[model samples]
Target: MTKYRLFTPGPVEIPERVLAAMAKTDVHHRTKEFMQIFSSTAEKFRQLVDSEHSPLFLACTGTGALEAALINSAQEGELCLYVSAGKFGERWGKIARRAGIEGVPIEANWGDSPALSKVRETCAAHPEAKVFCIQHCETSTGVLHPIEEIIPMVREECPSALIIVDSISSITTSSLSQRKLGIDILICAAQKALQLPPGLTILGLSNRAAERIQEGSPHSLYFDLKHELKNQAEGSSSWTPAIAHILGLGEVCQMIEEEGLDHMIERHNRLSKLCRFGLTQLGCTPVAEEYPANSLTPATPPEGIDAEVLRKKLQNTFHVLIAGGQDHWSGKYFRVGHMGSFSEADMRMFLGVLYDALSEMEAKLPEKAEFETSLCSFV
Candidate 1:
């Protein structure tokens, strides 16, 4: 039997050690052992993101954490600026709207990073905007926004606005330091760059963000960060937690510490460079030019080549899974993820398979040359 490999952005392959850790017998959530695991994992999360203040953990998806940040930071009917460049970015707008907040979307074309100037102009126009929400890495288009540049502009222009970032894919893949970046709320999930399975979400809240929650908002229940913090202070979750996932997360944290956070990010950078180089040599153009995502790369399909068909062939024939584009780009582009539980060898194999699939579809590609170029680029 052949083993299947996952190359999608979320639900990336889990490390064997992490899987083994999850296989352990379930422990009582109230026990000291569980709390120890929780505390240790929280510390590692802070170290990984280089946050001075620790983040809170929730047994939820990345979207749940995002909602938590939105609900806690801003009040109903308040102006919220959403910098939307892709699907996930648009989701932020949708979430804000659902929460009864007035969401003003700053639109950017898909495959394009959000412009700092545009964000600044929006803030200046809507001085009443209480929360500025943006995705650090837009997974759909594989575009990395200029958060570092935009953050300062927001800080200078709208000092009262809290910066909420969805760093789900960029947490470990890119060089991100939440505190240093001046982000008030940073939301991430274990299923992305953390190399763990879904079921755990983390929110690194700045003191300013906590104070905003205390000031009051209509957002309540299930995702209230303030309530979660109170429960976490006593070493517990407000709701029943996923014990096995927490155990797996503990092991993942150990692996991350052992590898060193900076080194891990550097590794991801190297792998992303290789993937981009290989894709370019294959005559496939990347979606984003200015700031391509470090975790995943979305490649536009060659003329007359159906990306969805190619993606299906890659999975069915080669036992490799790749993600298809979402929303408007659906079937037009496909994504190759190089984050979490993936190594240089895995990337080489994936690229080779992609080359073979494209060649079979009559898309002339410089397979051997591109592979060599990718290797040289990585080195």
Candidate 2:
């Protein structure tokens, strides 16, 4: 049998215990035992993001959660503003349009964060926008959009607009305070930094956002936030939920608590620095160099080396599964995920394997540095 380690931005390597937890006997979603686990998991998720309210669980992937956030709160044909710095950010606007909302996009170049001034100006221009959407981390480019900075600016410029954030890849890998950031709706997924599978999507709705959802008419039954909230109050979902994933979420939450959020964030930052330094030493230019994210590092190979080919060689030969770029950058770059249950030793092993693969491909490689200066900068 072949063994592989995932370095993709999503569906990250799950811990053995979490995998075992998901294998537990299935229980009815309405049963007392299931309800207890569901309630506890919801609370842990809230604490994970430092939120005032417990987030709701959706029996779908992150994309469905994003759609739910849009269709539930923003009405069709209403002005909805979106910040698009990369592929995921751009998808927010596309999702809005699909839901029949009028989407106004604010775009930044690939590998760049939108300027605060631009966002402020956009808010001023679209004062009637119902929702302002953005991503905490742009996974495709490894850009960590400064939600702390952008949130305050959005609130001041558009006081009435609901602020929705997609933190699918960043929630657990980075530090996020939903209440402090004044974010009205936060989207999360179990397949990313949460170290779980792809069947569950978690969402945190502010009091204001909840009120807004009630006021809107989505005309949809399955994604009605108001209806789901009612079901949640009774410790169930409007539809049959992912029972096994919920149990796995509980185990993952316990792991996060044992590690402590501060330590986990710090570890992610360290890994990011090491990954960037290592990639640079391998003659690859990392995207989002100025605002690198802890979740993953996207790198472009030097001219003449096919990024997709390198990724395949790493996977097929070394059993290391890193992700390739998406959308326009496809075949142009690759991303190495260092989030969730990864360690420095794992990184070293990955770098070694990558170095060997690059050598075999006859790719030009740079001399390795001691990484001492990079280590100092992380401090």
Candidate 3:
């Protein structure tokens, strides 16, 4: 089977070294050897979030982590405030409904940022709200929320409400300090910036947040944060983890350590620009031109051209798979992912193919522009 070079958000193109790490001979989850690997890998997660406590590992996606965090912290029937500017933000409401909590949204249009006054008003009105859920980067619209400004307002207006941020798609691509932000719970997965295959969830909880979780009994045993806190402190999991994925993440940590996490983040930021520029030259307009997330770039093809058709052609014809819009956006826009394991050179390859594909499709383009690789080079 041929592997399509993935320009999709995730599961992105995993580097060969991470793949090799996952292929290493499996170790027994209960053994001393496994304990060493588990302990060290867990610390890497702690460092990733700049947290003092070692993070809990889960055998689930970011959504499952969201469910686990929500179920563990907020009681059933409690009032919770969430941002609904994009699909992932709307998920907080869906998860709340499933858990029987009343979720009120600080709603906005798809590509717009949630207003501070709106968020502040919600917290003031519902001071008793258990949690305020938000996405650090709303993946669907490629919008990065003003969490830095919003978090402090929540802390002041609603002292009791816990701040839960799902950084599923933004973690390594952006710089987020859990302690500095005073976030109760920060959630991300292995699939995105870590450049690994899916099926592992990394969660970090503040001391206050961890204590709050222990005070309440979670609805399910498997999603119980209290149990995870107890077992992970002893360098183990309450259940068998995705051992291979954990190992692969360890490999990613080593890679970042060598590349320097700061440099990796800056590279992603540059890649976002590179992709947006390339797409524009190939005749597409930036869909979320303002406050765009450095993780990906969403661009709309020239008038009357279907974005899904263009995306499919790029994937099937050129073997370069980028992402298309979701829901109302499905046919209107497409996204080119530049997060994790993608260097400037990889992005150049994608641009070359995309340019040819656009020309073949006869896209009505503006004056042609060169990539000017020298300007975008990381070297």
**Top lDDT hit:** 2
Q: Report the alpha-carbon TM-score of model 2 versus the true structure.
A: 0.95
After the best TM-score superposition of candidate 1, give how far the Cα of residue 270 lies from its true spot, in angstroms.
1.0
- Give the alpha carbon lDDT tens digit for every residue of 41-119 in model 2: 8887888787766689999998899889988878878888898888888888888877889998888998999888898
lDDT of 1 by residue, 27-143 (tens): 888988888877777787777776656678888888888888887888888888888888888888888889888999989999887577788898888877899999999988888
Residue 79 lDDT, candidate 1, scale 0-100 = 80
The residue pairs found clashing in candidate 1 are: none
Candidate that beats the other on lDDT, 1 or 3, i.e. the better one: 3
Off by over 4 Å in 3: 366-379
Per-prediction TM-score to the true structure, in the order listed: 0.95, 0.95, 0.96
Model 2 pairs in collision: none
What CA root-mean-square deviation does each model show from the true structure? Answer: 1.8, 2.1, 2.0
lDDT of 3 by residue, 28-85 (tens): 8888888889989999878878875778899998899999988888898888899999
Candidate 2, backbone clash total: 0
Better of 1 and 3 by TM-score: 3
Task: Give lDDT per model, in order.
Answer: 0.84, 0.86, 0.86
Instruction: Rate residue 18 of model 2 by lDDT.
Output: 95
